[model samples]
Target: MKRLLVLSLSLLALCAAAALASAPASLLTPDLALERLQRGNERFVSGKMIHPNQDAFRRTTTAKEGQKPFATILGCADSRVPLEVVFDTGVGDLFVVRVAGNVTYFDQAGTIEYGAEHLGANLLVVLGHTRCGAVTAVVKGDHVEGNIPALVANIVPPVEKVKSENPGMDAAALTNKAIEANTWQSIEDLYKQSPIMREMVKAGKVKVVGAIYDVDSGKVNWLGEHPKQQELLALTGGAK
Candidate 1:
């Protein structure tokens, strides 16, 4: 047990070192990173995108210097929501993980940990969309084929919660509310599943926020941190 603990600590230190070695000269704080993403989304929404960091020079520079993305996004795999294009960012600007429903399972949480802990990204965004098919399926309890049920299993609880809480809501309203609830559920799953992310967040090294992308308006509606962020952080049982 002692040897295993030492090896785990050693690996963590090595990962931290690699991250620091490749980190940008000026690392953006969590708030600043969030602001940058908001500004980029504004440009995208207004059709005034400057297309930052897409140029050959920027690509070559990032390739040489190594990628140091400022924000890590966990978004839905909806074809309509192109994360970089929606955010108006370019090469090496954002580290992204996409899965249907934007659900945070063990693998998703671990990948998010890599992006935030091992890649030095302080801002973590869970980007769901306004009308997500995966969410819709879960909301309606649609019959799914092989493997798909497993994919959207995590969404069931949130959808059920929404239904139980909003018994008077119509189908459309229930679906809409469930979508938002699922986003929060993903954050909860992250805090529950990934100790790495929980510690980083508790240590003030990472911030996890949620957002919803509107496919029609091309705008990202930011939802800030979870309402019970402090409670979530407290689960880490460590210092900030």
Candidate 2:
């Protein structure tokens, strides 16, 4: 047991060293912030989490100086998908918004805009997760009660899209496809509906990418950036 613990510590140190060895310039660009999160998750999945920025010092510093999170995460409210733990970020490193299925809506867009436009988040991640209850509910057409039903409705379009595309695809495969579809659609909703976010994307100040967290494996699979977002980010200066 003691040897195992020591080995864990050694592995943690190695992951931290690798992350720091080629650190990018100050999380200023969306690509750089994405890379930072990718490295952090690598440490997490390898069981080598440094648990960076979660210390008393970090807590105190964030409290005293206010938050300046480098990334904004729109993730599911699933307890299993604890945003900070999955990304291995800590106090003030991530501005997170959680709702079932990680769907984008008006209020959610406002919150994300505040994070990016005001808080200076260069990276925006629309994170869906595997075996997501919300997507499952929609796929199964469950009779969920109350406002929960409305919440599940948010994920239905993606299911329909997946169904239309895949025809007689199996249930498990359909759910997976729906989750990916939902992730990409949320990214599109954010970029399309929010003029503030659109301007930010055009300026290259923010990049919105889609990802899905593998619930069973504790790994986040980055599904690449949105295409319109790609075109927007490629343009320099002003929102045309």
Candidate 3:
């Protein structure tokens, strides 16, 4: 029994070492990483997905060396919004953090900073989708039980803002508007709340952008245009 246990331990150690030896090297720049995802999404919608980098070899390499995902996605925990399938990315391509409504408070901000600083991810995406249950629950003011109320409460501000801004708008439009606002609000909160993320964006080491996924169409609608290197540098006051 003792000999068998020793052999098992030795094999486990060897596997760990081999995995470490095959880890990925370097990462794409923020803009390029975003473009790669964009292309992947386009391919997905167009029915031309190549399903790149999802093979067993890629999995083994990531498990061994560690992950160096180029883009970090802060997305909703909604089941239909599968980040990998939507972007058509494989293992170690994306560092994803999920929460209801995609809101960033203390813990979520810390998680984003981990992807940026620790994992060396250059792109951060706050991805929200249409018909999200969390946001809808807030809009409806449904009495949820347990800790869920606290989670849904974070979305109320945006919903209220939408109500105030568009008093006559119907419920559907209001929810949609609020969803966009909530997504951007989370992006801004990350800047205001986390010094690491703020500094990284200022230093041009990271780019944070907001996007919306249409569940009906399988399309990602970025709130603004894609990041231009010149514009980004100018916006950051030439921090890089």
Candidate 4:
């Protein structure tokens, strides 16, 4: 009986150690999580995909257990901008939210909050891209003349604000500016509008970031590290 007890205790200790080792380092700092993402993106842009999801057997095993995606991406419904390919992330690595123009309504905000507060996601990324048709429509004041008007209406306010602030800015510039503004607005909405996300941010449990993907170059410009509010404002117009 004494030998059996010793063996059981030893087995339990080994299991605990293995669990601690397997737990990701991002659980401690959001910066570490960001670093991981940057590295993955770099690999993607360099034509060196890590192919983290290729192991079907391992994926099935993990599926049977559970998932713990590290980051959540709120992005546009554009077919050209695929979240996983651009970021070089695998199936279980990211929780993604997609909508036309990347607009966040009450339900979308709740979904993002759940990813962070309940799904154990440590970071949130609002990703926008250039040459966006939705933004173009809003800039040109071209509502689709149907139920799509509501969607266009949601994207118009930020472009209008940008034009009002910089009266001399042209249509193309305004649309480009609004695409970023809309992205930052989504970032703000994720934090200011969602109670659960706000609490997580306040407690340092999660970090909210903004980014823009240049469709021409396939490069991801991280907005979180922008040095000044003016620069960020110039970039996204949600600088304050």
- TM-score, cand. 3: 0.82
TM of each candidate vs. truth: 0.86, 0.86, 0.82, 0.79
lDDT of 1 by residue, 189-220 (tens): 88877777878888889999998898899999
Best by TM-score: 1
Whose lDDT is greatest here?
A: 1
Full-model lDDT, candidate 1? 0.85
For all the candidates, what are their Cα RMSDs to the real structure?
Answer: 13.8, 4.9, 12.2, 10.7
**lDDT value, residue 108 of candidate 4:** 74
Task: Give the residue spans of candidate 2 off by over 4 A.
Answer: 1-27, 228-240
C-alpha lDDT of all candidate models, in order: 0.85, 0.83, 0.80, 0.74
Tens-digit lDDT track for model 3 on 35-78?
77787788788886667677898889889989888889999999
Q: Report the lDDT tens digits of candidate 4 across residue range 43-162.
A: 678786555653786489568966677888888889988888887666677889998788777767888878887778888888888998888888887748776777656677778888
Decoy 2 TM-score against native: 0.86
User: Where does candidate 2 have its weakest 10-residue lDDT segment?
Assistant: 231-240
The ten-residue window of minimal lDDT in model 1 covers 16-25
